[model samples]
Structure formats: C-alpha cells, structure tokens
Target: MKVVFHPDFYQVYTSDPAAAKGRMEAVVKVIDPFAGFVTAEMADHNDVAAVHTEAHIDEVRRQRLYPVAMLAAGGAVQAAQIGLAEPCFALVRPPGHHASADASWGFCYFNNMAVAIASLKNRGRIDSAYVLDIDLHYGDGTVNILGDKSYVTVHNVDAMRRDAYLREVADAMDRCEADIIGISAGFDNHMEDWGGVLSTGDYFEIGKMAAGAARRNSGGCFAVLEGGYNHDVLGQNVLALIQGMAA
Candidate 1:
C-alpha cells in the first residue's frame, strides 16, 4: 500500500503526545521496509481555506503551526486521491480529528479529513463519502464542518467493549452507500494504549471490513493516522491495519 507521509512529520510539532518525539519514528521503523512512501506536500491555501476560517489559518501561522498543519492536510489529500485507485494510508499527523472549521484542540490544527473529502467533492470525483473515525475520542471536528454538507456521513465509533466496537464498525460498513470510504485509523484504543479497549488484531479486522465495504460499493478506501500513543506497539498496530487494507 502507498503511504502518504513527509519526513517533516517527524518534527515535534507540539507538546501534545500526538506530536511527541519518536512517535512517527516508531511507526516508520516498522513500515519503512515494506510500505511504499509518497512524499506529502503542503495543502493549497485555497483548499485549507475551503474548510477553515481565515482567522483560524492565521492563528495557526501565529503559532508557527501553519506549515506542518498544511502538510498533514496535504498528506490527507494525497491519500484520498490515491485511495480513489487503491488503498493507501496518510501517516502524517498533528492528528486533525479534533479540529473544527473555526477552532481546534486536542493536538489538532485543521480538519484534515474534512479538507480531503471536501476537495474530492469539489473536484467532482466523489458525490458522497463515508468517514469512520475509530479514535478513542470523537472526531467532532470532522462532523462540525461536514455534517451538514449533505455529501458526507461521519461515524465515530465509541463502543466500550472490544467486540462491540468491531460490531459497530461492521454494522456501519454494511450500511454504507457512498462513493468513497475513509478511516480515521487511531490505535489509542489498543490494549497497551490509552483506551485499552481493543487488541492489535482488531485494527486489522477494521481495515479489512473497510476494504470490503469499499469494494462492495465499488468505491475507494483510505486511512489517516489519528491518536495512537503507545510508541512500543503503535507501529505494529498501524502495520496490521495497512496489511489488512492491502490484503
């Protein structure tokens, strides 16, 4: 699978764990040997503006976060575009699930999913999209911007049990009817991670289900990194998902 990434993602963009040192390196160490890498570019300012406010964009610049944030968004766009043809993963960060159109928090600066999906819609590549956010936390940012757009349906899975979560994903995938499916792949729910509700194998199942859904709908599928924080096992978890998607 092609992974959209940039070496700059290795820079500690913030004090948040999502941008902590070695976080990207840990995942990179494991996937580098097998994963095909695609260099990420900075998102066009117009694309960023399409999903964010001018004030929010300026605020990011004031905090010296504009450059990297745009790169992450750009990586998402690249991943989404690649997904139209094949499965891919955007392994870039400053995880954007928590960001909104006008505000941001939880280690996010811009809503990358919103930007990427909106761009695809704007270019007439997809008429509708399904977003599956499996992060430990809700992806309110994505919903805040795209919920009312009519072209997107966002599902943030928060089942408390491992089996329940998987079932929730299965149910959603089974019901999906869209031109594309995107996974907000987060590993924080892993047994060794923050949520401690899911196992590493679960990610693979989620990925496989997503791939199946896309195939069934004759659509495309892709993923972007979110809130996995356990460096020791983060790489393995991500790899499992990628392997399943590629399979």
Candidate 2:
C-alpha cells in the first residue's frame, strides 16, 4: 500500500506544541522507516475551500494557527483521491472529526474524512461511504455532516464496553452498503492510550472487525490516524491495524 506523509505536517498545531510534536514524531518514525512508500509534500491549499466553508477557512487563516486540522482533513481528501486511482494511507495529524459544520472544536478545524468523502461525492466517484470512527471521542462532526445524507454511513464507537461496541460496529457493517470504507483509526480508544478505557487488544479487535468489513464489501479502504498519545501502545496498535487489513 502507498502511504502519504509530509515532514511539515508536524508544524500545523492548535494545541500544545510539545504534544503535537510528540505525535508527529511517532508517525514519522513508523511511516518513514518503511521503504517504497511514496512521500508527497502537501503543496496545495486550494481544496480547503472545497470541504470547508469560507468563514471557517477565514478563521483558521486569520488566527495564524498551524492549520494542522485543515491539513489533516486535506490530507485525507488527497488520500481518498489516490484511493480512487489506487489504495493509499494518509498519515497526517491534528486529528479532525470533532469540528462541526458551523464551528471548530476539539482540536479540529475541518473534518478531514468528511472533506475527503465530500470531495469524492462531488466528483461522482463515490456513491456511498462507510465511516468507522474508533477514536475514544465520538465523531460528532462526522455525524453532523452525515446525519441527513444517505450517501454516508457513520459508525462511531466511543465507549468503555468492548463487546457491545463491537456488536454495534458489526451491525452497522452488515447493514450499510458502501463503495468505500474510511477508518478514522485512533489509538486513543486503547486502554493504555491517554485517557482511554479499552485495552490494546480491544483496539486490535476493532481494527480486525473493520478490516473484515472492508474485505467483505470488496471496496477500497483508507485509514487515517486520528489520536493516540501513548507512543508504545499507539505503535503496537497501528501495526496490528495494518496486519488486520492484510488479513
């Protein structure tokens, strides 16, 4: 699989510089170490307007912020575009999905996965998308954007119970008909992850289940790393996720 990454991705941050740097460093270590993966510098900011409203885009620019959230969202859009041509992974940071339509919150300026899905829909390339968000936090932004849209099916898991959450995820996978699967894979859902209540095993199980769904659908699957503060657990879970995808 082709993995897309940019070194400057670490520079875009709206929160503590230290935390953002830590996450970026971890992502780089994992992706850059692997050979044959294509690394592309994100040079275009034009698509920001395609997924985000003018007011929200203006706020991000005026604040002189890192635009990490926007970039993350944009990166997902780029990856999805690549997915149309070939499978790809978007390794970007400043996790989005919390930022709502009318406002930005929870360290997200624009919903990256949402933006990517929207772009695909607008281009008539995708008729349906299944978004599986495994972050410890609910993907409120994605839900808000997809609530009335029949083309998007959102399965958000943000609870402590593993079996129940997995059951919910399985049900959604069984019922939803989608041409592509977008996984908002966040290691924060793991117990060892910062402020997480589920174990690393549970996180792996979730990934496996999601991958199984993707395989069953025979549709392209793209996973974007969202949030996970613990380096050790994050690394392990990410590897497990890729393995699950391969399974």
Candidate 3:
C-alpha cells in the first residue's frame, strides 16, 4: 500500500490557521512511524467540469479556493488516480465531501473525491466506483454529484449506528460491481472526536470492517483522511486501520 501526502496541505486554510496546522502536524506525526510506506508528492489537480457546473466552479474559485483550494483538490485527485493505478491512501485536509455541485459549504471548497472519480471515468480507467463514506457527516456533495449516475454507488455510514452501518457496508460490497473503492475516512466519528458518537474501539472496528469488505470485493481501495479532531483517538485509530488493512 502506498500513502500519498502533501506537507503543504497543512497551510491551505487561512480561516483556522492554528487548527489547520495542528491537525496537519498531528496526522504527520502519527503516520511518520509507517516509514517507507509513504509515496512522493504528486499533483492532484484535474479539470473536472463534468462534476460541477461552470458557475459553481467560478464561485468556488472566486470565494473559497482562490489559490490554495486548487492545489488541495489537485492532491485529492492525484491520490484517487494512484488508487486506480493501485491501492493507495491519501492523507489530506480541509476535507471535501460537503461541497455541493452549485456551492461550497462546510469549509469544503472543492469536491476532491468527486473530481478524482470524474477523472478516472473520463480516462476510461474506471467503469464504475463504490464510494464508502465513513465521515460522521453525510457525504452530501458526493451523493448529489453522482446521484443520477448509475456507474457511481455511495454507501454513507452514520456514526450513530455501528452494527447496522457495517451490515449495510457488507451488503453493498457484496452486491456492487464497482471496479474501485474510495473511502472518505473521517476521524471525527470517534467517541472523543469533535461531535463524534462512536468509541475508540468502535472506530477501529469500523475501519477494519470496511477494509474487510473492500478486500472481499477484489477491488482497489483508497482512503483519504477527512475530519478527526480528537488527537489521541485519531492517531490510535489510524494506526489500527493501517494494520487492519494490511491484514
């Protein structure tokens, strides 16, 4: 498994300067122990006109992204590309599953995963994809963008329920014929996490269960760090997730 990350992602947001830096630093420190598993920085930029309306793109560019959001979105697309090429992980920030087709909200300037999927589909590398969104919040952006497209299937897990969510995941994995899997892994779902409802153990189990489903499907898997505010839980859960995926 190859982990794709960009150190500059820490500095992308000027809104919460300190929080952004802290979150980036914490994720880096936690992942540093898994040396040699990380890959060199690659451009994540892709012109995804299909996913967003031109007006929406212009609005996001004028307001949120300006100069940096583009880079962040680019990194996300690059991570997805790597996943399509082979199994990989994208450690990025300013999590983007909330931005809708017409506007950007919830601190998400661009729908990174959507762009990546669009890129892959356009290149003919991905005939279909299953998006497993584990964020505490619903992946409204992804759902809305790919809602009508049968080639894209979204499985959103609400942090409030564990068994039910996992069962749904299992069902989807068993039924779907997607060529690749994209996980919107959010640590905020962890018990001590900001607005989280699941315990540390539950969080680790969630990752393990999801990874297991991905493995069973014989499809490539790629996960991107979304939102996980509890530092301790985030670190521990991420390490556990890596181990689980390896298993």
Candidate 4:
C-alpha cells in the first residue's frame, strides 16, 4: 500500500498524547518496510476553509498548529486520492476526528477525514462515500461536518465487546454501497490501550471488512490515523490494519 506520510509529522506540537514524541515514528517503524512512503503536501487554503471557519483556522495558527494540522489534513487528501485506485493508509497525527467545523477538542485541530472526503467530493472524484470510523470515540467532528451531506454516510463503531464490535463493523461493511470507503482508524480501543476493548488483530479484521466492502462495490478505500495512544503497541495495531486492507 502507498502510505501517505511526511518526516515533519514526527514533530510534536502539543502536550497531548496524540502529539507526543515518537508517535509517528512508532507507526512508521512498523509500516516502512512493507509500504511505500509518499511525502505529504499542505491542504489548500480554500479546502481548509471549506470545512472550517476562519476563526478555527486562525486559532490553529495562533497556537502554531496550523502547519502540522494542515499537513495531516493534506495527507488525508493524498490518501483518499491514492485510494481511488488502490487502498492507502495515511500515517498522520493531531488526530482529527474530534475537530468540528468551528470548534475542536480531544487533541484535534482540523477534521482530516472530513477534509479528505470533502475534497474528494469537491473534485467530482466520488458521487457517494461511506465512512467507517473505528475510533474508540465517536467521530462527531466527521459526522458534524458531513452527516447532512446527501452523498455521504458516516458510521462509528461503538460496541463495547470485542465480538460485538467486529460484528458491528461487518454489518456496516455488508450494508454499504458507495464510490469510496474511509476508515477513521484508531488504536486507543486496543486491549492494552485506554479503551481496553479491542485487540490488535481486531483492527486487521475491521480493515478486512472495509476492504471486502470496497471490493463488493467496486469502490475505493483508505484510512487515516486517529485516536491511538499506547506507543508500545500502536505500530502493530496500525500495521495490522494496513496488511488487512492491502490483502
């Protein structure tokens, strides 16, 4: 798979776990050997403004997070574009699922998933999209930005049990019909992580389910990094998803 990434992603911009040192490096170490790396670009100003208020953009700039956040968002666009032809994974940070259009919380600045999906739509690359946010938390920001849109549907897996969660993903994948599928991949739900509900292999299963859906519908599929902490096992979890999707 083509992994959209940049070395600058290794820079830490905040005290949050998502911005901690070595977080990007951790995932890179595991994926680098098996994946091709592509340098990320900055998102267009208009693209950023499309889903975020000017105030939100200025606030990110005020905090010196604008560049990195935009870069991550750009990586998401790159991933989505790459996905149009084949599955891709974006290893980025300042996880963006919690960021709404005008306000952001939970260590996010810009909603990367929203930015990617919207950019794809704006370019007339897809008629409809299916987003499976497998984050430990609900992708309220993604939903807030895209829910009302006629061409996109968002589903966040919320089951507490491992089996139930896998079933939920399977069910969603089975029912989806779209031009593309996006996974807001998060690892915090891993058994060793904060959520402590899912195991590492569960991510692989989720990725496989998304890949199966894309195959069934003849659509594209991609993923972007989201709320995964636990640096010790984060790499394995991410690699699992990439392998499954690429499979």
For lDDT, the strongest prediction is 1
- Candidate 3, residue 204: the lDDT equals 52
Q: Assess candidate 2 and give its lDDT.
A: 0.69
Compared with the true structure, what per-residue lDDT tens digits does model 3 show for residues 1-247?
5666666676736665223557766666876777334433433333556677778878866765545556556666776776655556677666678877777676676677787777788888778888888777888988888767889888787636656665666676567567778877776766677654656665456555555656666666667767777665577766665555545
Please report, in order, the local distance difference test score of every candidate based on alpha carbons. Answer: 0.93, 0.69, 0.67, 0.92
User: Would you list the rank order by lDDT, best first?
Assistant: 1, 4, 2, 3
Question: How many Å off is the CA of 145 in candidate 1?
Answer: 0.6
Cα lDDT tens digits for candidate 1, 28-102? 999998799999999988888999999999999999999999999999999999999999999999889888999
For each candidate, give its TM-score against the true structure.
Answer: 0.99, 0.86, 0.85, 0.98
Q: For residues 1-247, could you state the per-residue lDDT of candidate 4 as single tens digits?
A: 8999988888878898998998888888888899999899998988889999999999999999999999999999999999989999999887899999999999999999999999999999999999999888999999899999999999988999998988888989999999999999989999999999988888888888899899999999999999888989999999999999988
Q: Number of clashes in model 1? A: 0
lDDT of 3 at 168: 66
Q: How does residue 48 of candidate 3 score in lDDT?
A: 51
Tell me, what's the RMSD of every candidate? 0.7, 2.7, 2.8, 0.8
> Which model is ahead, 1 or 2, in terms of TM-score?
1
Clashing pairs in 3: 44-74, 44-75, 44-78, 45-74, 188-228
In terms of lDDT, which candidate is stronger, 1 or 3? 1
Clashes of each: 0, 2, 5, 0
